[model samples]
Target: MIDLGALAKITKAFKVIDNDKSTNRLSHAYLIVCQDAENLEGYMRYFAKQLLCSESVPCESCRHCSLINSNAHQDVFFYPTSEKGILTEDINAIISESYVRPIESEKKVFVLSNAQTMNAVTQNKLLKTLEEPPKNVYILIGTTSEQAILPTVKSRVKKVEISPFSKTVLINALIDQCKDREKLENAVACSDGTLGKTLALYQDQNLKNVIDLGIEILTKMQSSKDVLEYSTKIIKNKTDLDQFFDVLDMLLRDTLVKECGDQSLITNPNALNQLQNANFKNGALISIISAVTDARKRKQFNANQNMLIEWLLFKILEEKFRWQKL
Candidate 1:
């Protein structure tokens, strides 16, 4: 059930593949970069269909399209089947199997998911196949960050960056699923043009609550004594911490925009007045934003959640006070 119409409206990644096919200049290796991990697989599948489908475009009714959609296509292979990610051994296996002919279709497509997970050694192992790919074979690598890939491997692949959906496009696609207009608007505003995040925010019943908590912290939380109280309320678990950080980041960014007298550019219109009244200095806001980013990096390395929350709050409060005196 690949919704070609919806995907076409949301992204242009497939169109790039289609154009390549129509012109008969299809690259042997393609690097698909998308920030939304949830929809990356769907993009990869569409790319595969464009290459294998007998029709000028993916008809969805063709055997190649059906097999690809169902993950039953023998000629189409997806690698790093485990959660451990792409390893040197997986690269070796791909190199070994790539020379074999396609089982059904005229072309073979090997999708390497999470290409960023392939360290220098593993990526190096993949270079030979990329350099001298078998006839009619395609290597499609999907990654969230292209910078993580080595330049040597990158130069050989045709890189396609997935664009974010426009607000109107996202609204049209999600309107049927979400009846709450206010919630839908909020989700779209906070999604940063990605459909996956918009859907997650729309379904989160606690989104409004989290946002309110973030506003309260920015406008009301004062002195070191309030840090523990806010931390307890915001950091019940890792998921809660992430949600809090996202909300806080958005609010801070909006506040900074407002402080700079650019009301039209702020994302959260509903919170504009609250942000305007917060009266945070630009220096303090910038420092707090940097602190939040540092906290997120620490969280990725298995940092203690409670300590991280407390430290982040302290930094915010200290900046608030220091900037107020100046």
Candidate 2:
């Protein structure tokens, strides 16, 4: 279980929900949208404890909280027990079971994890129950994609948007988990505000190698002739290619910041010397950033990996030399 107390955003959210419950204004249904699905599920369980616990503030030591923490609660139901995600059958089960009285607590909590996986048909099936659930029944739907949910379904539930943590909050939360300060900073820089991705990047042993390759490309691959060799070294696999692109994009942006004489805004502070020595002008950095964005888009659309890498490298070199000649 995630230490929800350590997460600032989640702690704030808990207070908001607690306030609602205190004022007797709790919504019957809530739609929580978060990019980090795994952590979202853990949060939902904690939310369940918030609703079911005997104490005004959830005493994690209580029977309700302990049952929820252990995933042994009789009243709290988590859907998509299989990797198949929330299906029509799961919706049917929820609907049928929601009408039943709670055995352990006054309120029955149903959580649908990965709610985005439910297509139009499944969502439509869930629309009625979502609109008017049984008395003392609370439903929580979590999705990474908010746009995928039907407008009617969205309208019925209170939308809870979980924003990414600030640099300070994330760093504080991860301090004890990761002892390496430099690697932790690098992971946080690349995390884009999501804790799951931050932890994944922090634990990734190959991340340093990927960053080194990105630096090599930016500082050493000066000529168009170097594209092929660099491309081969960068494109080990799709995942590695994506990581390389992230590092390259980050480094280029940091170099642009350095060029603008704003050292404070640089994400890769440890690479300051390299960024300082990088001779690429503002125009070149901007062009390279655009190329990286385009390349990432192409990658998503299943573009030929080799050709895409080659094209991106050529564009980077072209922009670098073009601006230098000016």
Candidate 3:
């Protein structure tokens, strides 16, 4: 048996759940999308536990409980792929698994994390299964909503948005996990209220260093040469490319806030003095943001990491318009 307790976020989903629970209103497939990783994972676990537990309702303790807790549930299947995101072979394997009946439990659940990584070909393959899921089968897809997953697949599944925690809540969570106050604050700001990514920064020293360096680079880019210099430094670190992208994303977001006169959103509160030093127009800021985004996407395809970063910096450097003479 599993106990399905109501947490604040869960309760919001419960209204949707309650309407369907009596009539067994659960969808054959569900897409849980959000920037918040903790809430997203919680929903997946809750859904899985409910499907497996012997008790009609969720009871956290039971035979099913043991399996899910140990991540050993035979019937509760997790989609396995080589990396953080889904691949073509992963979708194929998941489709193949769908045909098999549960080993013990009545329902077989497939939880796909980072479901947005399912490319078009994979999404097409999943469409048929999603449309006609086996009786007692549940497919749960999780991803950041910004990623453009196929609309065909999205339409077939019920969509649940998991809101990320507030910045204060996220900061407190990171604080609980980290002893270093400065690092915790930096991680909280860099993550922009995402707990999973925030935790990743805390665990990976290289990532932490990159975040620190990334801020410094953005602050120091007075000319194209400076941008290229910093990008070169980032290239040499061997830090997770995603982390670098994240830092750049935060920098742009902070710049946007500064542009909008919202000084509170500035992560580099100390750097605001310097950011104000370089007067950037909205057009220039947009250009810099686009260049960084493109560079990050290029890196995904194993594009020349150093060249791409340097090129991106060059683009920002070429934008000669200084801020309204601070």
Candidate 4:
């Protein structure tokens, strides 16, 4: 069950949904937009419970809410798809079953995950339902990229944008799970401000280890004559390269924040000693920050990961020394 308490990002969306339920104007289809697709499904399921609750709206005490929370509700249909995404057969089944009357509740909600993977053909098939949905049925589509969904499908559904929480907001939400203030802060930094990503990094020991190693390499890069030497070994360790870059981003961001006299705002405030005495000035720090942003953005286009890592590291070194030879 998703803790509705932590869903601060989409509180307004909840209000709108609640209003629709009260006024009996609930839309038949909804599109949830989020940067993290997996977590987006949680939000969708919670909304389904709200829409289908029997005893009271979103009342956890209701049997309908209980069944849905456990993912056993007959009225709530969830599409099972992971990295490969939804297929044609899945769409066909949904289209076939969408019109069925609800078994236990007044509404039947079809929750689909990773809408981006649905090819044009499958999406076109599903469009029939969205165009003319059943009276007692609702469809929830979750996707990280709204652009990936057919624009026609997008037009028929209510749009809910899930924004990433700020560092303060995220820490307040996760402080109970992690008592250590420093660990919590690091978790927030490494998570890029998403609650799901923060919890995942916090729970994964290997990701935590990579974060420490990435930070070590970053410290070495600050003073080492051969920054590329450290960066080369990291690029070689391809197993946890994604988490490594996330940590690396934090390190560079901390450096920039320190140079700008805002160390208090950085993720690793404990590293103030190292950040304060770093050799690079504001210009170099900004260049490194920009480079990290570019690398992250290019990841979506399936850029060469190894070469991209190598390129960003070299860019950091070049920027760091560009001002020193004067």
lDDT of 2: 0.83
Per-candidate Cα lDDT values, in order, are 0.82, 0.83, 0.68, 0.74
RMSD of each: 4.0, 2.6, 6.1, 3.8
Q: How well does each candidate superpose onto the true structure, as a TM-score?
A: 0.76, 0.89, 0.63, 0.80
Task: Please report the candidate that would top lDDT against the real structure.
Answer: 2
lDDT of 2 at 118: 94
Off-target runs (Cα >4 Å) in candidate 4 are 1-5, 8-12, 54-57, 81-85, 206-225, 235-239, 258-264, 294-314, 324-326
Instruction: Give the winner by lDDT: 2 or 4.
Output: 2
Off by over 4 Å in 3: 1-15, 22-24, 33-43, 50-156, 163-166, 192-194, 223-232, 235-242, 261-283, 298-304, 320-326
Residues 1-326, candidate 2, lDDT per residue (tens digit)? 33564572355566677777888898998888878876878767767888888776678898888998798999999987888889999999999999999999889999887898998999999998987789999998889899989999999998877788777778788888788998998898777787899899999988877777777777888776799888876666444778878888888888877767667667778855665556788999999999999999999999999999999999989999899999
lDDT of 4 by residue, 1-326 (tens): 33543573246667777777788899898887778655777777777887887432477768887898898899888875555778888888888787788888778889987888889998998898899887888998888888999988888899876777778887777777677787777778888566688887777767656666655655556544455566566656654666766777787777777667664587777654545544776777787878878888887688887677667767877787885665
Off by over 4 Å in 1: 1-5, 8-12, 54-57, 72-74, 80-105, 116-125, 145-151, 163-169, 185-193, 222-228, 235-239, 259-265, 273-276, 281-284, 297-326
Which has the higher lDDT value, candidate number 1 or candidate number 3? 1
Candidate 4 lDDT (Cα, 0 to 1) = 0.74
Clash pairs for candidate 2: none
Consecutive 10-residue window with the lowest summed lDDT within model 2: 1-10
All candidates in order of lDDT, best leading = 2, 1, 4, 3
**Residue 145: error of model 2 in Å?**
1.7
Please, what are the lDDT tens digits per residue for candidate 3 over residues 184-303? 766766675556666766666775577667666665667766776687677676656777777777766677787786676677554344455555677777778887788878987889
